[model samples]
Target: MINRNNWRLVKDYIKYRAEIDQVSAKTLRLEETWLEHTLNWLGEKSIDQAPRIRPVFSDFVLSESENKYSSEYLRKLVSAHRRFMEWVSINKEGYRHKITPAWLKTIKLPRQPEEEREHEFVSYDEIIQIARTPIKSLRDQRIQAAAVLWFLSGIRIGAFVTLPIKAVNLDLLEIYQFPSLGVKTKLGKSATTDLLLIPELIELVKRWDQLVRSKLPDTSYWFAPLSPETGTFDRSIKAVGENRTSRAYKDLKELLDRSGLPFHSPHKFRHGYAVFGIKNFTTLAQLKALSQNLMHSNISITDGIYGMLSNGDKKKLLSSFSPATSSAPTDLNQKLDEILSLLKQNTPIKSE
Candidate 1:
């Protein structure tokens, strides 16, 4: 059981995060859940007691590990506790000296397992297969279009589901992810994203866009909710609710099942977009453009997430490499040197 003082402190910390840090409600809820677990584990001990009792913290972590909790779960718990401790140190004069920076450094989970680090993404062929699958209803068609758009644009599911019809410009191949326009972009980030130039997929997305635009107003969600009675779009619905992503997820899962394709979460489409761009776009400029399209802050982030090539791709690429010779550097070598220089600088290379 948590002591009343500890509980009150936790609530105060959460409120600070909400009002001062301005974190999303979803993030606050997650932090609260993780902090609750920490408090429960601490039992009669207060938050300040956690750092002093290093062995007790290790034991708690051991217990959670035995329960097969993921490294991510442990990481979040560590973050939540660290934030609470920092808040306590600053806000509560009594605990100021207890929670030191060196003590805070002790609050860390073990390194993640190698298997957990392996990346899994939807393949290009898989997206094409899903797109080509026959649709039995208008909802099915919309889901297909959404899936294709996700692959082409790599917008997060949150933004995709909350995207309004007005934000998507098919003619310019641009998607304006503005929070002010009600697009729920991650961290409230706004960017103008470009669609991949796949004509067949572009046409498919356009067809759905045209249909929705003709029926619903610009303010309405492009992936509009269906009316239960009419079995058509609910025109009265202007904005998507919080449960929008869950409903969209379920619909996508059903469509994947019907199409006889294995289900990959909406996020996998984002990985697919990155992988496709990396494989197809050879120039450093093109790679930078691809990173920008994915809305990543830097190319290093993009490379870190989607850089690994499959075993077969690696084998093929290695086999195709030219034999080393004591000659002047080739164009490929010069390009690689330039890429290395730019990567070291950690800057975006502009396309010519």
Candidate 2:
């Protein structure tokens, strides 16, 4: 029941996003898919009619809610529609009058459910348990190393799977996530990321690095491909396909199964890294370093994503706070002021 004109407008908006915005193919596809849902909801009405028919948009939300779409998905759909309408208002004549900023602001989704908001992060103890699990083969060893590296470096799985042997420097505890070197970083971001200096984790990574380097050339993937017949490192296979993530995910699942541990997605390792740093790093200066190491653009981005404490942790933190005295230590007061100043500036703080 999608209107042909509306569909055409959607296509044009998608084209603009590709040619002008230059979003990643994955992001472009997601935006297109989200718009298709909007078009279906539009039915016989054109895009311009959306502003006048507010109830129709509410009906669409109700239908999606009944269909059990996640709040996150609904939020993204709203964002996509807002962007599309903004584009239409700017580029298509007469849409400026119809798709006003006020109408755009009306497009919103409700807050996420508490359960959905509370996601698990892989803990340091869990990583330790995984490391201690006996390795039965070279493949097991490789997966174990990959898990350790994922938690230590806190890079995305796409970048991890695509990392070349040369990009990792175990001795320096650094990972070069340069797109030019073919690391599939999110938004093509490039950074020389530092690995968390956990001695046990570093040792495991070192062992794997030495094995991979000795067997394969520098250009080869650090997570080397294994032979189907022998189930050992296949040095001849230098490149990985787009399906590498699927394969790597399956391997991680298998490793977790073997370790007799509950499954957490590879991306949870990233959350785990952030949570670990947030808990341990007390000063704003230390936190700034942690944020930069995670390759976040700014401290606020890092804080917004991983700053919230769990209910239990928050309770414990509040309970442990002592009664305020008439006067505080001079050094402590100075540090508190410095932290507040840096936070307000939204800039990195220098370590004292």
Candidate 3:
């Protein structure tokens, strides 16, 4: 029987599988959770011995894939285990067949469709109100500004949390989102975005940047986490090592409660950015260009996510058919206008 001591092998693999594989941060945590469940099931069986209970593993994998776990989650576990077995064989001889990669080929995943939730729009007034309110402390105000900038700029949270102060150019009213700095961008295409257009937000970001730079080197990260150590020096963006967005989300909810505003997370703001830009500033061609700035593949992706018509907008469309509606073209007016124009041309009418 596999005792707790033998289970250490599974735990060891779980710890390093993601880092060794160069997986995403979210992916690493998930694999660790799944491995914990699988090891519990194999309480007494050794790694090499466990898969002889191949039937048991198979049933558990399938059930987990179909039930508690989604298809995405199931696929990740299978991948993690396959890599774990490969690691075991190279480091600790004679466990090569434990993974039996063939079983992974037969595993089916629970595929979820693209998320269809509508993007929540934050109004200009709401932004101004939040800016005016007191945030209890300077740190809270910094978090609020970060949240606002995420919505205002359509920048990714991953890039947002790690942005260095040197990357910002407030004098030019621009932010070097990608190519200008070490900040990672999708496809690595970087462009500078104007920040001066939003004066209030510019003031907030300037204050935050000044506060951060006074404490850190110009090369230091803009968003650093709270340190538990007394008098420990703060680290660079990469050194902080944890996502600032999760805590930002929690703090934002509390801010909303005090402000009496409805809550919407940072991602929905991204969706709002796409839809809002389309609705206001431009035509379809212009919209495609804006969507490109947002790094979307096609205008259709922008339209699909942002252009679902609202009930109020639909009501306006339906109201346009009424006789009193000034927008409606009248048949009598069209005929009269045509006749008057013909008379002005001095055209003679022939009797049949």
Candidate 4:
């Protein structure tokens, strides 16, 4: 068996290829994490042990450990290993490879059952109420603006955190996702998304522009970090990310407590957008187009992710005889707005 210490070359190869091939940083990060973990576990201390990796990596991910990682995480680990090793065997000579995941048994993962995933967002009233909530400082207001932008645009959170200032077109009242600026478009393509309708988000963003970007002198970086003393932008490379996502969730949970409602996630805005599209001013073709704009490979992919309709929505689509009641008009309207906004605008989200 090859020693474990020689896996750095493979890791470096992945990182290097990902950079040149325009692969998503998120993908590279996951692959690197898995490779590192597997190498550490197998006592592989160097890059020379490329061949011995497949079995240990596969077994560790597929095996049931006491800590019990989620099936979904294991799936990622499996996929990353497969790609890296595949690259290794092809790029390097005679690295004995025996494992292939295509033949492996399917991993059973959790399905949304009776308690389906929610696509909830702040209601108009809730938004208004939130507006009235005291803002102690500029940062609080800025974060609130960022949150509202996600809801208004139905953007995925991943693209929003990395939003550069130039990607947004205040003149057009839209934010376009551009991969060149590291904006994570649906399939890493640029999208000019509609964001004009949200007066609240717009006004705050404009204020932020005057206060932050105007002075920061960084045209390329939208939503750059701000300094406390100057209130101008900072390029510390630290901004809203997964950790911010967790923090946002905690804050949202606190808000939910005040509202006496169950907490939802940052991703639900995307679902809200889908439900919105299906309900108002959107046809099947339009849905597919929207999905494509969102970087989905196919409309069916979009449906697979956000197709679970609410009971009320189902009843409306089914028939009057069905048990499901149509949802309230206003509730449906919000969903529709989100869908249409993203569809019509095709603007970039800042969550890269």
* lDDT per residue as tens, model 2, 8-72: 99988889899998887778889999887788778898888888775655457757678587766
Candidate 4 stretches greater than 4 Å from native? 12-16, 19-22, 40-59, 62-64, 96-132, 161-166, 179-188, 196-224, 229-268, 279-281, 310-352
Tens digits of lDDT, candidate 1, 1-352: 6778888988998999999999988889898998886777677887667676645554577576786776667777877877787888888878877788788777777665644344667778888888899998898898899999999999999999888999999999999999999898988888999999999899999999999999988988888889868879997776678788888788899989987887889998888899889989977888888887887766788989876766767789888776664335687687778788877775767666
Each prediction's TM-score versus the true structure: 0.91, 0.89, 0.59, 0.63
Quote the RMSD, in angstroms, for model 3. Answer: 12.3
Tell me the whole-model lDDT of each prediction, alpha carbons only.
Answer: 0.83, 0.84, 0.62, 0.58
Better of 2 and 4 by TM-score: 2
Question: TM-score of predicted model 1?
Answer: 0.91
Q: Identify the leading candidate in terms of TM-score.
A: 1
| Model 1, C-alpha of 325: deviation from truth (Å) | 11
lDDT of 3 by residue, 59-107 (tens): 6676655567655566667666555556665666666665555543453
- The global Cα lDDT (0 to 1) of model 1 is 0.83
Off by over 4 Å in 3: 1-21, 34-106, 109-126, 171-173, 179-196, 210-216, 224-238, 296-352
The whole-model C-alpha lDDT of candidate 3 against the native structure comes to 0.62
Error (Å) of candidate 4 at residue 328 is 25
lDDT of 4 by residue, 5-41 (tens): 3465555677676776667666667677776655554
